[model samples]
Target: MTANPTRLGAIRTIEASEAPAAFFDVTEKTGAIFGENVFSLSVMQKRLPKSVFRSVYATIQRGEKLDPAVADIVASAMKDWAMERGVTHYAHVFYPLTGLTAEKHDSFMEPVGDGTAVWEFSGKTLVQGEPDASSFPNGGIRATFEARGYTGWDVQSPAYILENPNGNTLCIPTIFVSMTGEALDHKTPLLRSEAAMSEQAQRVLALFGHEDIDKVVSYCGPEQEYFLVDSAFVNSRPDLLNAGRSLFGAKPPKGQEFDDHYFGAIPERVLGFMHDTERALFRLGVPAKTRHNEVAPGQFEIAPVFERANLASDHQQLLMSTFRSIAKQHGFECLFHEKPFAGVNGSGKHVNFSFGNGNQGNFLSPGDNPHDNAQFLVFCAAIIRAVHLYGGLLRLSIASAGNDHRLGANEAPPAIISIFLGDQLQDVFEQIAGGGATSSKQKGVLSVGVDTLPDLTKDAGDRNRTSPMAFTGNRFEFRAAGSNQTVAASMVIINTIMAEALDFLATEIETSVKGGTEFNAAVQAVLAKVVEQHGAVVFNGNGYSEEWHVEAEKRGLKNLRTTVDALPEYQSPEARKLFTTYGVFSEAELESRFEIGLEQYVMTINVEANLTGEIAKTTILPAAVRYQTELATNVSALKAAGVDADTADLLRVSEMIAALRAGIGALDDAKATGHDHEGLAEAAYYRDSVLPAMLQIREAADEIETFIADDLWPLPTYQEMLFIR
Candidate 1:
């Protein structure tokens, strides 16, 4: 007669929905709030002595080695700026190899002799921090007894003020490393790879008769996708809380099948959360540019304009943190797990990347007549060659256990890594492969069947959402990145591979020209050779197509289907050579990442499997048995009264109960077997055995969900969680 005790979650969620949202007021304009909390260049210019400020600014702009003498001055300026704004503490924030941010906060109040504290922040403190090295996942790079990990300031990424209800702290972005110089975090390799790529890019530019070229920094604009569910629903499901996904929920009758939710109007509660989150991001100097409903009912996405890759990666981590805190305030639990809900399109972080130097704009830009632009063609060829040579590494970069649920699902890219140059670019490459590119396709105006509206010029190339890497107008959007992953890994791999490819092409061009071939002729020959050898990696067709998978395998392109399959490629001889060549990651550092990834994959699946078994035995089974009892008792009475009673309901319940119990037993067995295994073998066991058992449990549990009464179902239904306010 009454709602289940677990209904408290739903009640709380409803109440939260009804509560009025607190608004963030933007009193003036972009100039007023923009970089308000950030220790930006403008902030430094105002606070520091002009000479010191310029020294720091020049180092940042030109990628010069940091002057140790200027560190004290900059730290002093940074400290003064923070203390004036009521900041009492500073945190050296670093992104560890675990794809998460780690920070160590220190007090500014160093006690003086008199029982009073003096606000002191020195260059030594600012430049270096030592956190427990053994605590973080290091892929066996450091022993447990080894506790010396260092954090050094990444001067390119500006420090920012982080606010809490209680107090504020200044956050400095830094790179984490081991004492032996192995990268203990993502940022170190990212910065090194950027430098390597820039050096080669400069060489290529010099060939094109350019002199004023600053360091080429990769720009990243990641569109983040996530699901939002009420605290009530999230609390009711242990799977959502523990595993970050619905382990046993059945598909809603009306899921995203109608495709109505894609780009739909935002729900009021969710919209308010987005507004507040964007406001907070703006104050942190993040340029959030887009937000909208995603394909699934509860899914949403937010994007920012591209920033330099290193800063963007740091901001991305900060943005995810912002989403969690801001959504909680609005009574929503943000789910960054790739597939939070089964039977719906999952999430991804589509990383649109392009690189640029000081005045030379976007290097990836293949202009109107791409064939005529030899410089653009060479750059484009570098990407084609890079993707071809290290396609496996590219696939490896985005692989993870969470992402396994999303990729190859039609909604996302296939496991096969390939480039999509669109029709226009693909054609040019085809022509170059045959001999040389001559003419290029041009954009034409579209009337849109309306006279009042101005005619629009359609892009020469249509967008392909299914492609893992697609060349948009000016950038290659790496669409396969998991929503929960750090872009640093992907960017680092991209930079290293591109550096190798660029160097290889430059050498070929130089050798040909030096041998008395015309400069333009040498460039054409190199592009032709690159395309002829690597063009198989470029496919503009639907990557989701079965034929493409077959063709890809035939073409010898690697299809790294899971984390286990992809991670081993990270330590391949070619991969080691590429990273080492660029000074991005040493052999030890790269192997360490491989080890860490393997462990993470094993750990993630083991947890999910265990949670699946626990939830099935505890939450789901109890509900099923109670409902079965009611159905059985009623049927028995009808049978005793000599009326014919259908046994179908009882039989179905009995079969499902058996299946559920069987799944739980199977998963338990699988987990035990997985634990007994070692290294990649253990990860393989989880991917092969453990995942199947979990799926079996989910299948039976989901079936039982349909038969159980609404009130008897303890957890929130997919219907209620996805559609209810």
Candidate 2:
């Protein structure tokens, strides 16, 4: 049962062991070691011919096809750089539909005629790789008999070196698709969505005299929030070890109630981990920009600077994987579950998105007068129309069993998708909606109460965390993404939906102009039509309130509350039309995604349900019965001795013990009825029947923990786990 000793290298494995050594010696002798392992622009420039380098750069920046001739040069450069860094193997790293990264490593060694080997990597090997599709979750895209899957290099994302004690491998970011040309991974569809957005956005930009721009990319900066618990405590807690979250922990008496954890000083151990993570990220070309304590105890957030959506999503996956590895070194376990702790704030990945071209021109940028900026108004209206038309798709994009526990809770956005424009932009949107002409407002410089204070320029509006989607200056922060989700799914939906909306706007504007309307009038007409039709999506109020839910219902917004409710919308006719029209996903591909999502939901809940039953039967039930027996015996002995024990306490303890047994019996009954994983029925069964039983069992177990003696409690308490750092 021991792990293979060969897998353990020079780095000592922790065993009945203390925390890892304080510092890792990442050398500075190669001061340029920061990106020395990556096949980056700097490496390319040094290794490639000037013409070849320019061609590759053009392909990456402009989204043009890579020249076949230049592929060999790029491969040579990548191979040489990787070999120099002690890499003996290479992998086509991809994000599969499983919502995690997948890779197949192959050694670069080639055999010569006589007992000798030479390292070799060719353009064919670097550009494309074939891995079996049967083993991966393909959602029926590829049959079991047809096992071919292709990994095409995404040159836009640079290749990096992944080092482990076992070996060093070069990882090329790639897109995965089936042999039949259907997308089998998250990245392929994301790239298609990006392409669709770029084409339409460029057309929109051309109307504003930005003809020099070849493409416009949607950028994302996802703020990832997570919690860290001591590994010892985590391992001891069966629920957390199996579920990635505690299923039966009583809420700590002190849990984020005083707003003390928010922005509090970081613990030294956590800070050390953060520092190490950031350093690793920086060396890998990830622009990690912000780090801070979050509202919940043991929770924190790390945000990166904005990059093109494709690269941003790729980096997010890498960051999460790296975080897990680094946390282990720091004697911590990183929990990305949307709701890891009860009665406290949960984690969310806040996605900050914007549209821009190569010239650094943001389409959503409001000039001196946002109201009068016709181009900005048009782009903003496009977003409004897209969100309104496809709110269901947006909801489905973020739907998952884990996130179901977070959304509509105080910590995260409500299930309803509504826009928050703040006071200033709300006024502008309303003015346009009312068909009133708007004039530019004069810029005001703020003067301090004293002359010693410097004059300051102010932003137009304040932030609203209540909004599911909020326009924060230049970007819209989509706050519904769960911390554990791959950013690709959400970004793909946003990009494709916006692309369709922009295309609609462009066609309408062009038709108006052809029909003798003036250019300005046509633009205004498009904006007005968009505001009239989709303005219902805009709400600048508290979404967490009951009033907002009723208001949303009145406005006809669909509130799909859970994964079971939201996921079916993905295969709706409307979704099929939208995705297929933009070429983001074929009908088959969409159906496949729906199947995969549903299966994943069922699988997640089933695992949690099984884990709950195991912990309850093996740990909780036994502990509770033993404690109850001891209490009963003590009470009986005291009564026989004519000494009055606290009868009330004994009766209360007996009552809870009875209730716990009932809950255990109910859980057993639920488990006996096995789940049907064939269709939506399975999802509904898990959500309604199985989940309620799980919750009931947890409630009883948690109550017992609160009353039981510390020595009798078989699991780590929330107080110990949450405050142990």
Candidate 3:
């Protein structure tokens, strides 16, 4: 006699209601509260002895080995600071290859015979610790029975306090390794790659007559995008909870079509959430510099200032964790999936990267006269050669189940990797290839046509949103990284590739100079060779266009359109040789990573398939049938009552009932057959067969959704979920 009304009703209530008033007071001075929870360099300087602090600082800055003699003093100082801040426990935090942060906490208190406790922290414990690493995904490095793994302190990232409702814990960033010494985590390889990259970069700098060059580092400033939805909406859909995306929702009636949502005013509820999130980030010493509404309803973006790649990677993990934890407190579920809702803009973490040592800033920066700036030209040429040689590996770095929904979607960059140097550099490089470059283009100032507004100095070129990698004024922005990923993989791959390319350039120049050739002639000769061989990867046009894709294939560029197509490339002979030669990864590690990527893809599709079959049978099929029966009953009653009624509704419901049954049967059949194979074959079955069947089911179910009355609909509509604020 009645239909349950909860999903839609809850959404309606939230939509019509105003946001809750602030439950807590906010501090106005952000600087006053900043770094309060972090054990930063300043804190270490104040707490440790002068000699110990200087030694530690040198190790941290130059990536030198930590001295054993100083660990005791440093540990004592750290323990005192943590205990003073009411911390009773400490954890060694590490990054596992499963794209997550891992930590095991230990208490600081040790009981004495006199019924008292003493807080103790030792240098050995601070430097290294053993954890049960069998459970972590090690890619066959350690068997299930062999569970030993080590965690070594990463002094580059600072320690910070993580608070719970009851207590706080000290979290020290560390690198995790398997028992056989293979890297079981992303940080270890990333750190190694950084060291290799810096050595080669130093040699290249010496050729340009720059002495006293410090160790170089790759910097990353990632811009994160995410969507926020009410917890009620998220929990109601089992697919969302299990798959981190909505597996079965019809396209919303109005979604991002007018472009009004981009840079739109923040909703009151969302503003409060942003405010609290930023304050928490600042306290953790995460330099979150920008936050704004993005190009879709309910989507937002947060960007931070650039930092060293190692610290940046750690901070990214902390940032994602912070977003999720804080979202729960605000009654929201933060969606980091590449595409949560259909027919809306997906989220991507645009990673801006560049390299430099302490003496010179930003080697990618094209100075006022880039043609005359030999140093910038050398580094820029190195990047071009690296990308051309390793474009396939770059694609593999971002391969994942979630990102497959975003890349090549027209709104984001295509699967093809290319460099977008601005017009000014493009012209210079063209001149260099032809013979030599002359003068450089300078930026011009423009008036706003109003006396009150000042004139703006516009850059020589505009930013390209459609390129996978675009050269911003001082950095290259990699726009294809999915939102949920750790930045380690992308940066590591970039560093290794750059290392190889830079070595090639340096060797050629060195040999030429030894042969009694002029240095200037040697530099120009190398640049000309680089442009002639590797210049095909540079493109300034729209990457999403059809013409570019066709032209790219003709130019011999790879178009790895999906994870399945691209993941296998990671084990290619060229990729393996590059990694091994540079000491970034061994062959076994490469094989393991490839296996992990394939396994993840297969499992992800399997879950979505199972949920699709179950939801269609348990929820969708019954709903459609009940509505069909109701319409039949009404039609029969009208005929018995001798009143004519429209037969159109009855016919419509019958068609949907038949389609739903047929779609569900097809999906069940697909899942039953696709499981017989393993490795790439099994992944292929899911991609080619099962995924298509799942889509068919969604198609029929969405058609049924359009006809069902609002009260009888089992799932919340996209309109309500997206626009309900």
Task: List candidate 2 stretches off by more than 4 Å.
Answer: 1-34, 440-456, 674-677
Clashing pairs in 1: 9-232
For 1-725, candidate 1 gives per-residue lDDT tens digits of 22665775576547656644554684647668878999999999898888888888887899988888888888998999998888999999999977888899999988888898788999999999998889898888899999999999989999999988778999999999999888899999999999999999988988888988888889999999999988878888898999898888888889998889999989887888887888899899999999999999999999999999999999999999999988887778999999999899999999999988778988988878998989888988999999988989989888999999899999899989999998888888888878888899999888899888999988887999889999999899999999999999899989998899889988998888889999999998999999889989999988999999999999999988888999999778998888887899888888888898888898888788888888888889998999899989999999999999998989899899999999999988888778788888888988889999999998999999888787888888888889876
On residues 475-543, what C-alpha lDDT tens digit does candidate 2 reach at each position? 899999999999999999999999999999998998998899988888888887888888999999888
**Candidate 3 — worst ten consecutive residues by lDDT sum?**
19-28
Span of 10 residues, lowest total lDDT, candidate 2 = 2-11
Q: Rate the local accuracy (lDDT) of all candidates.
A: 0.89, 0.85, 0.89
The better candidate by TM-score, 1 or 2, is 1
Candidates 2 and 3 compared by TM-score, better number: 3
lDDT over C-alpha atoms for residue 481 of model 2: 94
In model 2, pairs of residues that clash are none
Clashes of each: 1, 0, 0
Off by over 4 Å in 3: 1-4, 12-25, 113-115
RMSD of 3: 1.9
TM-score of each: 0.98, 0.95, 0.97
Cα RMSDs, all models: 1.5, 4.3, 1.9
